[model samples]
Target: MKLGRLNHIGVATPSIADSIRYYREVMGATEITEPFDLPEQGVKVCFVSTPGETGVNEALHSALNGTQIELIEPLNSESPIAGFLAKNPAGGQHHLCYEVPDIAAARAWFEGLGKRILGSTRIGAHGTPIFFLHPKDMMGQLTEIMETPKAGH
Candidate 1:
């Protein structure tokens, strides 16, 4: 499997609005987009860009060079983010998403090593196909493998 790059760092928060303010005002980070509800994932998320003093719209669309910090607040108790927050009340880093050239190949590689997957491959909140490898099988951290869309696709 050809691993592409570090896609984004997912942060599970109790409140999306509060998290956005914390990242923008306190951390001096730029808000890339307003909080968008992902019904499929049962959470509201806001992407914040890493660089630049002023928040620009282009930052949200450009995924190649910039790194995005994803703030996720679950809408329901059954949501994965909510489950994570329930486990850790303080709300911390949830998962790290890495871009891969082929999700099938990546999944096969991990399964070949006898690692357990949290679930089957599914479309992620960001519209990328993704799957999570169980933390118990990993080094005490849940790892996400995602396949980003091609230029024309």
Candidate 2:
């Protein structure tokens, strides 16, 4: 299957509050969405616009059509993000997300290539289907494949 757009870079942080501060105060980010929790995913996440990109928070219309930075922090000890933070207390890039026209097609293609898909497709922070690819098959970077959101989402 053909790859789609680079959606967002996922960052695992020990604290979303701290990361938000860094993006806003030091990085001068002006368009950050408020942090929200995904209990099913066991993380709290926020989206920060890439530096100098406007309309990052305008997802309903006119938002940046390219890459974004997604800040994720563990919601509890059992959270998946907790393990990431344990390995990196200072936090770092956790994964790269790319949009796909059809998630099932993408999954099938990856499986055909013998790439390990981490888990069943699940609803992600964007309210769309998403799944992760193991870093081993992806040159040391965790990859997230997401179904492109429909218009008006």
Candidate 3:
């Protein structure tokens, strides 16, 4: 299966608002999307577009190669990321999401290799099908595989 692109870096936070402030004031990131709840996932999510990667042409970087930082906050105590926040109250990087042409194929390939998939494919924040690969099988990082968005979103 072909890996498409690095979609976003998931960051688990106690407060998405606070994280937005830090990203704006400290990191000087200004393209943060509004935080929205994903009840099915028991979390609130926002995306921060990051520019200025070293060695990349700024024009092309902003136009086509920019990356996103997804800030995720638990909706309630029962949220899945609640435990992660409990372990690190300050919040931190949670997972890495990668784009794939076909999530179904990616899932089958991983399963064929005997890797554990966290759950059945579900609609993700990007409005695309996604699935998570267990950290143990993926070098200690929770990996999200998402189907590439259709043209025009």
Candidate 4:
């Protein structure tokens, strides 16, 4: 199967507001979008984009010029970010999502290799079909495979 572009890098944080401030004030990055809550995912997310080397936040921002940095703050203890933070108190990179042409084929390929899946495939907020490959199968990184919605239904 063919690999697609890196969609976004998910960063787990204890407080979305704090992180937002850091990215905005300290880093001097412009907000690409406001923070929005995704109850289904049990987290609040915000996107920020900057021009070039202005501060610490913009430093990492340049590396992800074409992509986005998804700052995710867990809403409750049951959230995945909470679990990740429990293990890594300072928070950490949660997962990486990749746009794909065929999520089914990607899933099948991983399964064929005797890999375990964290959960069954499901449609995301934007109607994109997505699935997560167990971290064990990917050297400690949770890999998400996503496909765009079809023309009709």
User: Which candidate number has the best lDDT?
Assistant: 3
Q: Encode model 4's per-residue lDDT on 1-153: one tens digit a residue.
A: 776767677788888788888877888767556778889878888766544334558646554454667788888999988898999888768888787888888889878888888888987634688888888888889988788446762
Clashes by residue pair, model 3 = none
What TM-score fits each model? 0.84, 0.89, 0.92, 0.78
Model 2 error, position 140 (Å):
0.8
- Ranking 3 against 4 by TM-score, winner: 3
Tens-place lDDT digits, model 1, residues 3-101: 566778889999888888888789987556888888877988888877533454764445455567888899899898888898988688998888888
Q: What C-alpha lDDT, on a 0 to 100 scale, does residue 51 get in candidate 4?
A: 46
Arrange candidates by TM-score, descending.
3, 2, 1, 4
Question: Which 10 residues in a row give candidate 4 its minimum summed lDDT?
Answer: 47-56
Scored by lDDT, model 1 comes in at 0.81
* Clash count (model 1, backbone only): 0
Kindly report which residue stretches of model 3 are placed more than 4 angstroms away from their true locations once superposed: 52-64
- Residue 137, candidate 2: how far off, in angstroms? 0.6
The predicted structure with the larger lDDT, 1 or 3, is 3
In model 2, where do residues sit more than 4 Å from their true spots? 51-64
Q: 1-153, model 2: which lDDT tens digit per residue?
A: 886778899999998999999998998888899999999999999999774356556653333454689999999999988998888989999999999999999999999999999989999999999999999999999999999999976
Error of 1 at 131 (Å): 0.4
**Candidate structures ordered by lDDT, highest first:** 3, 2, 1, 4
Residue-by-residue lDDT tens digits, candidate 3, 8-122: 9999999999999999999999799999999999999999997756676866554346569999999999998999999999999999999998888999999999999998999
Top-TM-score structure, candidate number: 3
